[model samples]
Target: MAQPSLSMIVEGMIKADSPKPEDGWTLGWDVVVSYSEEEINKNLASRWEKHRDEMIKEIETQMTEERRPGESSDEEDERPTCDIKLELGAPRIQFVSATTSPTVNLLLPVRKGSSKWSDKQKTSILPENSYQICLKNIPLGTVKGNYEEIQDKNRSGKLPNPTTGEGECRFENRVPDHDPSKFEVSWVVLDFSMKEGDLNVQGQMAPGCELDNVEDGKTKVRLARGLKVVKSAAEAFFVGTRETKFSPVFNVLRHALVTVKNKELPQQVGGSRNLTPKKFRMASLKGSEVKPILSLFIHVVDGVDEGESRDLQTRWGGLWLNTKEDVMAPIPSTHTASILIHPKLIYKDVLSRSLASESNKGWRFKQLVGVEGGGIALHAALQCEFRMPSIRLQFDKGSGRIQVTVDDWSKDLKELPATIHLHQRAMDERPVISVNWKFSTETRRTNSRSEKVHPALDVYKEVTGDITRWKTTFKLAQDVPMKTNSTDYDITLEPDMGKLSQCWEITEEEGETDVWDKIKNFFRVAWLSNDEVFKDLVVESKESMRKMIPGFKLGEMGLGFFLTTNLLNPGAKVIRIDKDVGFRAPGNLLLVGHVIQGTDEVKSGKV
Candidate 1:
């Protein structure tokens, strides 16, 4: 047999100015439920009787309407199929946990007071003017039909119900039960200190509170068994503050009263978890901490599915008074699990800009706030273009070539081709530079009248030039081109006299006289410097000085040679003969060209 439903019994005391309370209070909730058979039970038989009458009426009306304004309503043989219900029971309540042990019962303190107060007195009464409130959880249980057995028997023909229409039907009900072994019964009593006009209590009362169990046909429990009172004072002190003028008490005490007369009620009877007001208040010079608390019960009706289990699990959830780490208390038996989380930021954003100068054109970046790792690594692509120093060059239109030999100049020339074509040059006070075009292929749109047929050219050229040659080319372009007729091209091609015999330079080395000669010939042909011959003469004179004197300083010998000859001259040569002392040259070889060391330097002349 299913266990009978349990109910709560409440008894309390309160002031006269409060709502009238019933004997006790109880709340009903389903822990497990069978399908709702209320409609099937309430209207099965009654509905069939009504359907029979309606069908007869409808058939008669249709028959009458079908006639030509004069039809007989004689065909009323049809009967309704539905039936009125003979049995319907009210919904029942189920306990969160079932009682496995027969001796299961609820235990609570007969008196509502703190442990500290209980130690002082087994039973204590409130002050004459003080308000008293009480709250506690009540135990309740439910009863339901054995639906599984009912269904099984129906399949076995123990219960008879028609498979087709126009017959009686049977339904199975699945009820919930509480396992007493699964629950820990404890009472949490709240004694509120409420002030006047601050507490409000409302409820329903039958033929007055004087009714017996059967006075009114309805089952009822006393919500606030006797009365609920609210108390507060405009001018109140913190304990003994009223007797001490130097006390730092600033705020008054606010209190409310709640009476608990039931033992098996759900949280719906208790209202919300946070019932305390959150109004800000000013404290005295010596501030005091305010700790707010909320209390509620968690009801875990047994035999519920996963969804209902999870939904009902959050019987109490909100901000607790303690930090998450400190809230290490064990979870209550009423819930599957409990979690307290504290979320915070890892890092903050630092707004800043690039550190390098604008000329560098190198992109710099800063880290965003709270990205990841200690330092986030990010990669982004940057494309930048900048202008290089301008190089202007003038070219000779005849040869259409600007020849230049540059040294010690470093610029990016990888993108430039070996040869360039000159088209334009810039002019300014600064010396001109010759720019050479590096050819490339590109497609560029052309402005056209017809939108459908846009045109483009496939040619791109860049200019690069050396500074000295750039200036010379610019000057040459400014002057008229030296004329050389096509017929006299050969004659004009012959090396110019001024350039043909120009001496070139050669440097001394440990070896390679032959190399020097080859280099001299090549450079002289090109009208380069005359240093090659100078190097040769210097090498020979040093040998001569070594032979004439032992252990002679190389620096002294170099100086001596410079004094004896214009060492800067590449065409210079020492006069000597085979087994002979002197050989004569045509021109003077004075060290300073006669102008510096001539006899009193004959009349100064200007070039």
Candidate 2:
């Protein structure tokens, strides 16, 4: 009650500027306050002067009674004291962009847990609870293209440009059309911050650091101790003639920042904020890729080998593909006139479809042209402009069927065209050209069910001619779908060869036709008894690779047909026949179709 000795009155004082949980920098505890014990004694000296003598004598006697020979006491404790300590709080988090020329400003959301503080002031206090940070703003970035940078003024708005010394590598004197192994990069910088009151730090503050490196000329940074950055999409690193043509670096980085943040992330906190932080999700690691389908320009000559067996598989002629771009010396003069002309061949739709699945965002088809001398060029005309829902090509040797897997399951029919070229000279050899037709044994079904499904093969002559001028023998299968209900069909003979062409429909139409013509044409009869007076009849073959073609068909219901044709002098020996499947189910059913298109090769001799 006697004011307890003045020496015992003072305790400790709290330091003001403590770091918050959201702050990016570190805080070390070393703050201190000085207490003036000597000063206080001097200021009160006059007032206690009279008793000073007695006080000194009594103090000296008590001090002497408690003193050891060489011990030094804490003088301030015996006199007066003032203490200093930082107010406890959490550290804040900040965003650090890998690139110097960062183009965008973004805010990462922080998931803070319930604070164990006694009051509001204590809530912002440091070392209270650790919070998780996440961001869900814009796309990861663009590839191979330039982009503008964006900044947010409210939070560390300073944008980073091409950071110095982050020298972009460029390969000098590389091969022609060769891309540099390295890349030029520009990035936008972002700084994240937090006020002391907003953070509740807990657990040992995590240690972190980052470093950058270059591989094959491209710049890449490594983080030693921090969250791994993930991209939402696949990014290309190398961009010479191969790898990727675009700036995949930015794509990967942007996707990492945006996509990863939007999804649920893993939580590292507990208690009132027990809601676990969502896990960070990443795109598949297989990455984006594409494959090329090949096209070969070949030339064939008869009489190269005249030994073995088999007519179609004979050992007479040899085939030559233009491995070199420029034309080779024309076949030796001797073989020139006798040269059975057949040039160019393609492995139709022969690339894996799965490779196109992941990179469907910008799916494209390309023709791989690898010359004998290593010269390569890509033709866009051969590229597939869009991705199918499903990417599968099916061919069964036993069934003699080909099925192309489509992405859309609703439609069972896919229309494809077949076009063959006949050299102008080949048409001059034979007067009356004959066409031989063949069919595959495989039957098509839809959704695993083969009920009444008759594959149809309907052929229409391309030349326009008088209906009565043409004579031909053909059967209308009852299973072929048509607008009309007819059983027998045939062609009639006309006087001139031109007349036969008149009855030929030249327009490119799909298997289905209008109701009027469908019914009208179905009943037409084939004229197989007419006299043959034509010579050297020829149809030219296409010079380019076989592209999808268009055509029309005449059909009768309840029947299906497959047709093959042989000219007087068959241009190419074998008409590589294959089936095309338009639809497929997991089990036994497959909706099959055909991609009949002209080959780039032209046949020079009679069929």
Candidate 3:
């Protein structure tokens, strides 16, 4: 009974004629598991002594913090209860596939190389449908005979998987045995190239049915996009496949799912009786040849109604690389002209009980750089405010609203806090725009109070025409009087039109449409709003701002911004002169809107 040398396997059944084959008999039902319990022959009473010290320490600390309170818990005197159950559920759909599109490789250079940059090489993609979409499935078997073969192959293994080594994967497809109604999705395996959040697009069904690619020679088409919904657990099934460079790219555009069969197939002489959901599509052709892939379309077709609470999952994700799909040549063309650029701000902030800790706010500005080269560059600076709860809400009550607040309110917003500073010193201005958000935010501040004199105000000239019908709500902020470098003058102020609509383009009816006065005011104020010392260098300037910068200590901060009197203030922060912003290279330099941020570092360094 206690022999390690003697080994035996029980197989024969007590019933007679059990070995006889039958249609209802399961050939795989003969598997048995061996259990071990050598320690049962020894004593377990002494094992508790080994953990006795740790047990006592835990018990002693349980009452330390809560002992001061009179409240008690029933768990303290009586041990808590535990319930264990072994409920079984059906397995979910699981599939694995592979695809290739050389265009997906284009993202590598963009992600690895320095962004917002250009080289001698042209950014292009390989022909679209040139790459084949190869999908192979994994097989599932429970037969002892087949399992034994699999073990033998692995022992003399040239590869871990022998079935896929020479043959394809096959599985029996089945049907749902439950109800339908609710939906829940979760990812057991998540890999994202550029996923922002939840599933905005799945399969070919995108939000708003955007166009994916052109077909009628030259008609406009929407860009194809995809997002992941969920992933399954590895234990749900073992998945093994070759690693491909285009690994996640295929999933970003397409996906696979498992489903049950509606009816059983007639078990033929060679084929099994299982059925699976199958999908296929034809690729578009170009002039008798398959054209290179330019975009993707993600579509999802409902194939299973496995009852209430269906789960959608697949292994999905992509590598990081900004999405840019335009071609810009050395010379300008129709596509290169009048390009519309949209800026997106990504905010990252922390909420906390303390006002000082909560004020830490920052944002990331990301966009695909255009080829037009005339697009505006951007920089950000901001001051944050956080308001705490007030006790006054508890006393005043006609409203059923709960007026809870934080302990303190952060910095004041009256000073025009968030600003996107426009550094308009040159035209060849594609300066590398990586900024330390904290440092850049603090760099905008000056020791003198007049530095914040709203720049947008200087351009909104007093209305010469009749405005009796206009409400006071439309007018900008009031003016402020500040003296700088022995020059005392009142500089007009205006709220940031960024928070409102601002007209920078001029069309017909200048007075009725062009708010150039309102739009240009901020730059004038920002020019003069320099520090106390630089306020002197800008005093009734005879020479240009750029020429004088190299000779002075403050030149390192970059030049061109100077503000004096109304007549003396430069027309705009953006000025054209040789060597503008003191750039050493020869290229088209551009500056765009600026963003204001807050930082602990005050002194200016290379941003």
- Per-residue lDDT tens digits for candidate 1, residues 515-603, read 65556544443421233432343344333322321110000000011111111111122111111101000010001001111122112
At residue 340, candidate 2 shows an lDDT of 12
TM-score of each: 0.13, 0.15, 0.16
User: 11, model 2: CA deviation in Å?
Assistant: 75
Per-candidate local distance difference test? 0.17, 0.18, 0.17
Per-candidate clashes, comma-separated: 52, 106, 53
RMSD of each: 46.2, 37.0, 36.7
| Backbone clashes counted, model 2 | 106
Error of 2 at 135 (Å): 11
Error of 2 at 473 (Å): 18
TM-score of 2: 0.15
Best by TM-score: 3
- Measured with C-alpha atoms, the lDDT of residue 130 in candidate 2 is 19
Q: Which residue ranges in model 1 land beyond 4 Å of their true spot?
A: 1-350, 353-398, 402-607
- Residue-level lDDT tens digits of model 2 in 1-607: 0111111110000011211211100011010001111221222222222221121100000001133568576553342211111211111212122223211222221111222222224422122111122222222121111112222212232223323221211212332344454222222111222222222222222222112221422212221111121111101111111222433332222211100011222222111011111111100000011011011111111111111122211111111112121111111111110001111111111111211334322223343322111111122121232121322333232213322221221211122111111111121121111111111111111111011223353222222111211111111111111121111111111112222222322221124346765454444311111212111010110101011121122111121111001110111111121222111111101111111223333211100
User: How would you encode candidate 3's per-residue C-alpha lDDT over 213-236 as one tens digit per residue?
Assistant: 334432222122111100011101
lDDT of 3: 0.17
